[model samples]
Target: MHFEQQTPLNAFLNILFDRYQEKVPAVKKVTDALVAQGVVKSQQDIVNDHIAFRTLGVPHLGIQSFEKIFLHHGYQKRDYYYFEGKKLNAYWYAPPSDQYPRIFMSELMVSDLSEQAQKIIHRYTDPIQADPVNGLNFNDGLQIGEFFHRSLWPLPSKHDYELLLAESEYAAWVIYNRYYLNHYTISVHALKEGYNHIEQFDAFVEGLGIRLNTSGGKIKVSGDGLLKQSSTVAEMQEATFADGETMSIAGSYVEFAERLPLPEYADMPANQLTPAHRRNGFETNNADKIFESTYTGQTKA
Candidate 1:
């Protein structure tokens, strides 16, 4: 939501919310308690609604080389999800307007794991022989926002990230967070009304003591309940590994959608509705429990 327009899609979404709010401290402890509880007026009046990534199906990378930087800035590629007990594989694009923010992106079926987890994910994506976004320079929007924080390989040994977090905590988070930005959504029916639904924004994010990803309930919905999600459980962050040692792992989180409206636009006129009468895309059982907002069973429940 910080787009001051260096435009290559606002410098790839302002360098992915400035390095995902610096490794996600519940994203500025919930955007500074939603700008000190007035809940709107900063963090660009919050309304992102989508921004996820976590790939590594191996060979040059996943989700077909990380959705060619938002399908080369015009997005589009919708639907198609598949979790199947988290072997994972997903999609959902549709941006190119509505001032951008809709992209999901997932992957990690590195041949459905276990051959010692595809030989420890081809031992760090087998030295990525090619397609690091085809060696970038994709019309430089600050070099595609620093090619999503570069470092495309090597650096995974905390016993190979707890042996790929015991076989797939989404492949030990894309083999040590390569491509990082793994969550950022917050479009609670465009707020401004008692925090606009998601059970009143999960009771204003559990009255700011935060920590909500209760796996399948602290709100999820969407079986025609018109999309209502919740998240915020992945914020551990210390990590050094590559044998140097350091620990606190999990790292990113902060989602809270709502969407609604579309029961044939219910009664429209929520200011004559926009974002096309709401309830759009995403909901593979509410994103397979919002990908366990960075697992370890919701970051240790």
Candidate 2:
């Protein structure tokens, strides 16, 4: 039997330390809370304190973009839906796999209308209750509360609903999908030895063959407004692999993008077309690099 050990002096290690530097207050607060509850002993007990991680939530626009991108690819679309009064949408995608870990795309509307959506963004921006046991303070904040482009996964579970709900109605809807995906764990580990690790671990139904969603698929622009497309586990038509082969592998059909074009719903209520960034309590554009949206929504965790 063989086991892989940690990579030495890797990018993950640097990220871990950077995360530590950035989220000290939150870490300390959490640790202190744990210590107070007698779950932890001291601040030193916070092992691998340098590691940073994130939990991303899916947006409505991302879901639409994903549908278009995937259809452009080759994966077959299993199902799709649009919710009324709740600028939310979802779709299921799968490929040829003995174990299909279905990919779900969800879009949350958070613009001029819903106050619930606004409140969720606020909680994400502002984390309350600090922990002093680990000397943790609520500082060196995480922009997660801020609105921008990101892909998150292993959404909040039933138990996490209250916490997520307390944050935003949109989050509540986003996290509810966790039950369908077995509430997997997504940890961004900046390894102590080195190497940045973004792992998505979860159990998919055996023989159900699921594929990772990508953006190489062709686009089918709607004559009117909505775009219609499909995806397959087969190779992308114009896709070329670095190894000099067609880009049609098992998980080849995916949805990814540097940005999501805002939808124009002139016929629909103006409140329905509100952009998520507007409701997201955080700044619109913070990073120099444009964050790409993925069909795998919020795997950034």
Candidate 3:
């Protein structure tokens, strides 16, 4: 598959962001709040550190298949991460250029779950025996954008969802929200004046009436303390299950990240630094808590 480089990258990303904002109202709110606070001129001025996705590890899917789309677009797969407690395998992809946002994709290890959970997952995913991304026309920006929001499987019944929820909240989320944008992080350090740090941005968000994920603390910092992160709690949406039963469940959320300058760059002049001067890649400990943004306990109350 070949990615069409003729299409302006910013235009493609805008389409994805627009569609994502339509589904996740919190994104618009947070961005609007930032603009209202005079932190930036508009959403266009805000830099996206990355966008994340969640998937199920089964034939025809998971990182193996899901990654091909970005890979075709010149993204290079970077670090590999595992969430033992969450039964997840993930990786981050570096963009071909600085103008594009980084991509973080994670897949749930279906076999790692209990038999009942695995059976429930396979009951929905087993029918698709071929990789679905293979059918897409990567050259079409609209088609690529639609693929990200498309439903890959039948919606789960409330009963099955709760059963999986009892085991893995991440599994339950992917079951209903296939290929949905999980969250897009703002590069807090990219902001100017009052909003350049996550701590300041978190307070700014709370002032706008947004609740944060406090599972491991409001801010999850890396061991070296150069990378700090925070996110708003996932929003609850009414979902219609396969049985036509409706229930409120967590949808998507927004994340804020601050990658501080490396120790060596601490003494350098501001004009002398480059993107490489900041901490790169993600931290497992920070991500472990960020993943809790979608848990029922965190989103429900």
**Model 2 regions lying over 4 Å from their true place:** 1-61, 65-74, 85-87, 115-168, 172-301
Ranking by lDDT: 3, 1, 2
Model 3, range 1-301, lDDT digits (tens) per residue?
0123547344456667776778778788888887777887777687889999999999999999989888888999999999999999999999998767899999999999999999999999999989999998777777887887777888999999999999999999999999888888899888886788888989988988999999899999999999999999998889999999999998889999998899989988755666689899999999999999999879876
Model 2: lowest-lDDT 10 consecutive positions:
281-290
CA lDDT, every model vs. true structure: 0.83, 0.29, 0.87
lDDT per residue as tens, model 2, 1-301: 0012332222222333333323223233333554565544764333221110112222322444334433432435665545544344455554233111224444554554356555544444234133211231212122211111132232223434454444444455333322111111111121111111211110110112333222332222233312222121211123233234432111112211111123433355433433231111111121001011112232221
The alpha-carbon lDDT assigned to residue 162 of candidate 1 equals 91
TM-scores for all candidates: the values are 0.33, 0.24, 0.95
Judged by TM-score, which candidate is best?
Answer: 3
RMSD (CA, Å), candidate 1 to true, equals 16.9
Candidate number with greatest lDDT: 3
Native-vs-model 2 lDDT? 0.29
lDDT of 1 by residue, 1-301 (tens): 8977576778768877888898787777777887888877688888898898888887878889879878988899988989889888899999989877898898878887779989988977787799888878777888777878877888888998898898778788778888878888989888777888888778878887887888778788878888888887888878898889988878788888888888888886787888888889988998898788888987876
Q: What stretches of model 3 exceed 4 Å from their correct place?
A: 1-12
